[model samples]
Target: MSQAPASFSAVTPYRPSDAGRSLMVNDKHRQILDGLREISQESSSRGYHAKAVTSAVDGLRGCAFPVNSYLKDGNPNRRCIVYPDFEIEFEVGSYYGGPQTDVSIVDIRIFRSETKTNTRAALWNVTHTENESGSEWKRSRDPESQLKPTPKCSGTENDSIKIGINGFCKNIDHAISMLPSHITRGNETSLGKLKSSGYQLFYIPQSNSYFRAGWSFVRDLGRTSPSDLKSSQILASHMREAHENGLFIEWTSHRGGSKPLTQAMKLLAKQGVNVAGKQKVFLSDHTSSHFEADRARRAIGMNTTDSKWHNSTKGIAQLVGGQIFGGASLACSINELINHTKREELGGKIAVIGSTAIGGGIAINSTYEKIGKLIAEHGVSPALALSVLSVIGKTAIVGVAAASIPSLNENYHNGPQDPIKNLGNKIGKKLIPQG
Candidate 1:
């Protein structure tokens, strides 16, 4: 990692006032930003600006949150991660030139202790708009248009707690102007109260020449503090957990060799997360047209011989089978219903419907078994797979019961039938086949 350039010391500190609270950029944060800019510039020179900047931030000491799990879009220029106190947003430029190539801190808003009637009390707030002229940079200035929060920061109950609100606005002025009335209205309104009331907002500076925005929440942050481990270790643990839980993991790596993949698999095996013959792993590499993923597979195999890792062929086959069987069962049920509607005796109609539903249930159960096998084959624990399938199976049974009971009732009361004694005989013959 590159050190912050010495010349960055000459840059003036940014200070902004909110109500009576004054926020200033301290030396440590300045140095961190300066270091980030140095990394960004070096990366931009090599035409790898976005990935390099994000990688630097992800590895920064003290910022140990697992960013990859939440962000899976494979976008190169933007990334966001939330921390307990604050969140960080990175907007990387596409090309090198002028302000487009420059990496600068755009805005920072800190929640401060509230006093008196005014709700807006900023512990730290600064906005830098000197680079606002960059061609790629655009921010919404119309308060009316901007009042409707960004989709990512819409202040919904669950979202406010998990991800909070971090997005872009033209400047601090525009951001303040766009604050929902409820946020700007309360007295003695602390961050905790605002959070409880479900009004959370964070803004990214629009001055930098970057457009795309991506953000993700860390659900496990409470369970495992990022401060406990280095960022790399945190990331590795996240990857292992994702694989063990049957989640699809994807990340962009600029490294030149297969050592990363080999080592990762070895770590997984060491942690007992990868079990041979019990799970299958799939590797995908889009780095080159020569199919480097094949090479990676061989490397992983060499390193972790006991781990079962292979292609997606078996998974695809199981998925196809499940779909085919599920469709066939649905079609058969509908067809049986039609045939039952045509029956002359109400008892016979009800019996045929009952038999058809039982057959459909059997078919659905078989489909669930195939799906469970597919899940288990792909590294998920059998218990987890069975639990999931069990839920689906129970739901299916309830649905079948609900549909059948209504039809039986309607047919029994509404349709004409023979004498009561003959009805039993009619239904018995329809339900059971005789030689």
Candidate 2:
């Protein structure tokens, strides 16, 4: 390996414990590294060297400090170790128009940090550049300034340490600056507050599948007034939990172009990341693409095509409709019972009302249960099924009520009279003609 910079010579070589190695090899870590490799190779082929470098560095940042703590099996108490001006070699298949077997010596900064419960073993890559003026802290952002010619690997096969380029940052200060303002702006005394803030790195998993992982800065946006802070904090907490549980993904806001979000989603899908039906994704209201995102997510196979707002509205409508239908049915049933048994005794009236109520309740409950099962097992549209079944149920309820009215009237009027005998007597009197 190339000699460490004079300023970093005092830094010791990184050696992770066995526990750390296990943490590093977890699925999340491997997916991140694999994604970075994909980004590097693809972006380099397209001559987007700066993009490749920056994206790789950003991927590294995703594995750092408190962010890693949120990752699966990470140690929250582990301290961060920074290796400044570290050098490593990368074998590239192609570089600009260089030879196929060219090797590149890349100067990277490495950081070792722990997850929540175990030390993470992965080495993070960062790159720093000094301008022509040679100021230590000053770095150029120019794309051309970031490129370097290929060089042979300095370390031999016998070297104990082997490093690959996963990601890099310009410097430690740059990394700190990239953090959300809430954490970085607070004073040392607010360290506890910072720790409790629940800020962590989350990536768009779909983007990762396409080799271009998109990251978001997730924290309670402190831009609001103090009055809104509590609710904002709660929302932030829920969002963080959702992301950590793989139930949600978020996309960065798109600034311009009509339907840019849709186009971007399409591009992602075309690039081999399945965007449909995988996990719930959050689109900022600022983008005004809520409808667009839903359409894209559905077209791309996302789990649900409806927005939360849309679903909520549908639910409210269904609830209101059900209530109105139930109230009307109850009123009609009561009115029918009262009118049909006007001459019946009080005890008989009470019996009829109680029996009718019990039967109606049982029937409604059974119908709803059956409908629910059908929707769950057969992939039925809930709205359609409920609407159709509800109409059928209401009709059946009214029919049962109306059918019982005649029997109830005959049985409870004066005495238990036989309807067939009464009909025969009336017919006999008509035939005898008052003889």
What is each predicted model's overall lDDT from 0 to 1?
A: 0.30, 0.29
CA deviation > 4 Å runs, candidate 2: 1-267, 291-300, 307-435
Estimate, for each residue in 1-435, the C-alpha lDDT of model 2 and write its tens digit: 233333333332121231111122224334443554566566453335324433433333222322211111253222221211111222122222322122222233322122111122111222323478762322122212121111221122221111111111232233222322222222345333323321222111011211121111112221222222222222222223333443433222211111233443543444344433433443322213456656655654554643441211111122223331333344454454345533223222322322333334545555455434443333334444344344434533443222112221111111112222232233323332221
Worst 10 residues of 2 by lDDT: 159-168
Best by TM-score: 2
> For model 1, what is the alpha-carbon lDDT of residue 165?
17
Best by lDDT: 1
Q: Which residue runs does candidate 1 get wrong by more than 4 Å?
A: 1-7, 10-294, 297-304, 311-435
Per-residue lDDT value at 127 in model 1 = 20
Q: RMSD, model 1, all Cα superposed?
A: 22.9
Give model 2 RMSD, 1 decimal. 27.6
